[model samples]
Target chain A: MATIEELNKDYSKENNILKKLTSPGGLKDKITQFQADLDLAVKDFKEKKKKKEYALSRNDRATADMLEKDLETIRKNVLDLRDKIQKASDFLANQQKIVDEKFEELSKDPEIKQKLDSILYKKYDRKKKAELNKKQQLETIKQIVDAHPNIQKWLKGIEGYEKSIRKCDKIIDKYKATPPSTPEEQKDLSDAIDEKNHSTKSLADRRSDLVDYFAKNHPEIDKNILENIHSYGNIDRQIAGCEKSINNYDKAMDNLSVAKDTNVVNQTSPSSLAPVPAQKPSWFHPIQRLKYSINEWRARRTQNIEPNPIEPNASAKSTFLEDVKLSKDEYNSEIVQKYLNEQYQENLHKVARQKGNDSNERGE
Target chain B: MENDFINITNEDLEKLSLEELADLKIELDDLVSKVNDMLKTCDDILNKDN
Candidate 1:
């Protein structure tokens, strides 16, 4: 088994490989080269098909067949490369994670923990500042809430009433539209209607109860403040924001304390175990390069960045399997259609408003 | 409904003592603050107005 130092060296090598594979220039070059090769093979196959050269002579037929084989090989190569690249990326990522976990383990040593104090302290201090700011904001919001007695109750009641009303309306609509095919269905509809009526009554009662409670409990409270209570909705939001910052502050402080308890181990201890080679990695095979290229091309395609064009021979016999090739026209038309639909909706609304205005003028 | 989610009907609010109300406010403020942070992050990602 490899020592921790050897493992660290392996991790670095894998990291470098991952970086090279993901680099835009290297990835793009490979994709462009693949496209160029595909375009040439496709062009040759189409030309022979256009002339009916396959039927004219056995030699032409052999050349056409050979071209078809080449294209298939290229497609397979692309697919295989894509699969390999994905596995390599996943492997490297896992390896990096292992290295990170090892460092975290080392950080738990009392010596290492003491060394990490400054870094951990910096994080904790930032969180403490944020906590103080949030506490101030929360206090402001709480003061507002305190000044407006029954404000929280009013907001909650109003919101609840609205939600309940919507649910009741849906039930009423469903009952009216469907009626009831069976006796059980009829009973359900009746129960739903009764429940809706009860909810409506409950909402009305809550509103009057709020008014009466405020009047009896706090007679000095202004009527205007009661009427415009909804304006203080932002207080609820601000209070929420403050609480989150406080929790984060607490969590960060806890982590800092844990770090303080850990030993201060030397960071360079693992590096000293193995001498890293200066030369390029010999394990980076040509096959890995091919995979990296295909994976990058796929990534670019997913992001809607147009790849270097591989010309399609429209008349050529398609021996290749159908792939979802990205087209600029189809993509552009989707965006155009969305814009046109919005304009159409706006025009409809405008026409209706104009007609209403004209009718109102005639009535006046 | 004793341990149900904090659906404070007028009756429930009325039954609460002054001390309980203060505790409830603190608890709610903490819960709301966490939710608000989560929502802020979502708004940032979507680039939408709150």
Candidate 2:
């Protein structure tokens, strides 16, 4: 059996491989890149075909045919690569489960559990410190923005617009709930909605101005940070979210202990400790024994029988080419037909110009 | 070709001869095979205990 440290090392190594196979610039990305290349090749072929260049020369036609074949083969290869990646991903996932089980078993030891707890506590401490530093940074930004009168005015305008919009919303909601029966009430609701819309537009304009102000005067400050500066409620919500995540981490650690207890209980449970029943004696019944022997012989005979081999269809040779031709026909019917119509219109215009030119010459 | 397969462009593919396209297909096949080999190695390592 592998030790906990060894298992952890192996698991980490496997995870790196999995990351390489799935991360950006990895096999998945490479396949997507190849697919993009194939799409481009197909598009180029279509353009060439549209220009009737493929029919101009045997070499061009051969190249087009080769492009189509290569495209199909590359597409199949991409799909095969995707399948292989999926299999590798699944295998890695299973490996993760095995490693987790091993870790769970090892963690049952008090020494290991203590070490894990200390590590987790240290991580939690670091996270808490990071969050505190972020809060301090946000506070400093807020202070700087508050000291700037122009930005403060912009924030105040936005706040006033938001407040008026909220009031309008309340009026609108009240009218909608009771449903205005009188013309006066209807007018009141419509007025409220118009006012709300005006305020919303004004609010958006103010926000845009604020963004512009930051761009011109305070290009050093991040626009995103400036946008969030006035929204203390959003800052509070973010803090709450962070706290919730930390609480969840704590819960998970507690659940680990609970899980260990459950495992222990399950190991000693009645079902798992159930005794195995004795096998049936052969001498109990002759008639039943003969029936069993006949059934076993029949099973053996069926297992020995060979299945008939399937014959290959001779006509399947041209199927791929036919499919390619069908696709090309579909393409031509849509895009090439449009091109032909344009050419016909241009020819008609030329003929009309020729007639006008001849008439002028005859008159002169 | 293997090193810069990702850099292969539409214009490049468009200009390639039939024989060159065939060669590209072979390169793609080799890339897939290499990835498969890596996967197999990882699998062997993971299942060594089993």
Candidate 3:
């Protein structure tokens, strides 16, 4: 058995070895420090969770979905309104062409030309003043008779067409208001517009057929009038209304704050959003135990040093003590398992690199 | 008792008497238990939060 002096020397030497393996800058200190940080993170996460401070709710999700649906419906309705207005304008242009043709046919007649000349009055000459005055009064009466028979049908058709166009303008005004939210409300508005459009289509088709009938009956009308037909009047106001309604819908969607429906709670802790963990976890628990044991052993040494303030007789201690050198082979044996694992991993890396090089050579 | 000092290198153990090594082994076992308790407590607290 070793004397107290020998035991103290061995203890000091063991402490030096332990300190080398486990002090602040050593591997054990790094591992324990990481574990301590992880433990602190766990505590922080728990405290935050208990308070429920960062709870995410799906309160406005349903409302947002419903609003989006309504906006989609509004977009489709605005496009339909534009298409309907375009078709109506095209129908109106076609009708205007037929009316112009009828007027042209009447104007081309010799009798109708003579009537316009008489109504407008020929250049008055001072030499034939009495003759012109008597003739002008008779000419006005003749002009009225000529106009009465011609252009009456053409004038009536245009008047009716203009009245229908005014009705379309009123319907367009109603369409620019707030669109329906529910399917039932949408159907009601849709059915009303469909009924109005169907009637308008019927009226246009009938009027166009009538114009065809008139042209057939009055074959003297020039065919060149067909070439003169072009789009007429302004649908610019209706186009602007459609654009404004679309913008209004877009603004409404933008203003809405829809809560995100996420399963975030199940995935990770809300406290995890603070920042990435500062410490790397050294997952081995045996290293942790070894670290604490080393600390306890060092603390005992400090306690021993504090009590023995007087210097020991170092010369007398040296006479009995032998200088010791810890073998490197023995140190290696202590961590043999770790050494073997490192070698195995190194071998695996070499094998993988060799395989890669062989495959590259094969490709060449 | 032998297994308790498994992490302590055999070369370091050769410097001490069997009694001293046994004492250190017991201390190490106590430390292992304390560390295990700490780790278990952390896990339990985290699980409770879930």
Best by TM-score: 2
- TM per candidate: 0.21, 0.29, 0.19
Per-residue CA lDDT of model 1 for A105-155, tens digit only, reads: 546797865445434444444444544444454454446456766756665
Worst 10 residues of 3 chain A by lDDT: A226-235
Model 3: lDDT equals 0.40
Residue range B1-50, candidate 1, lDDT tens digits: 11211223444434434333333333333333433333333233223121
Q: Return the TM-scores of chain A for each candidate in numbered order.
A: 0.22, 0.31, 0.18
Runs in model 2 with CA error above 4 Å?
A1-130, A215-222, A229-364, B1-50
Q: Looking at model 2 chain A, which ten-residue stretch has the lowest summed lDDT?
A: A309-318
Candidate 3 runs further than 4 Å off = A1-17, A20-22, A26-28, A53-364, B1-7, B18-23, B45-49
Ranking 1 against 2 by DockQ, winner: 1
Clashing pairs in 3: none
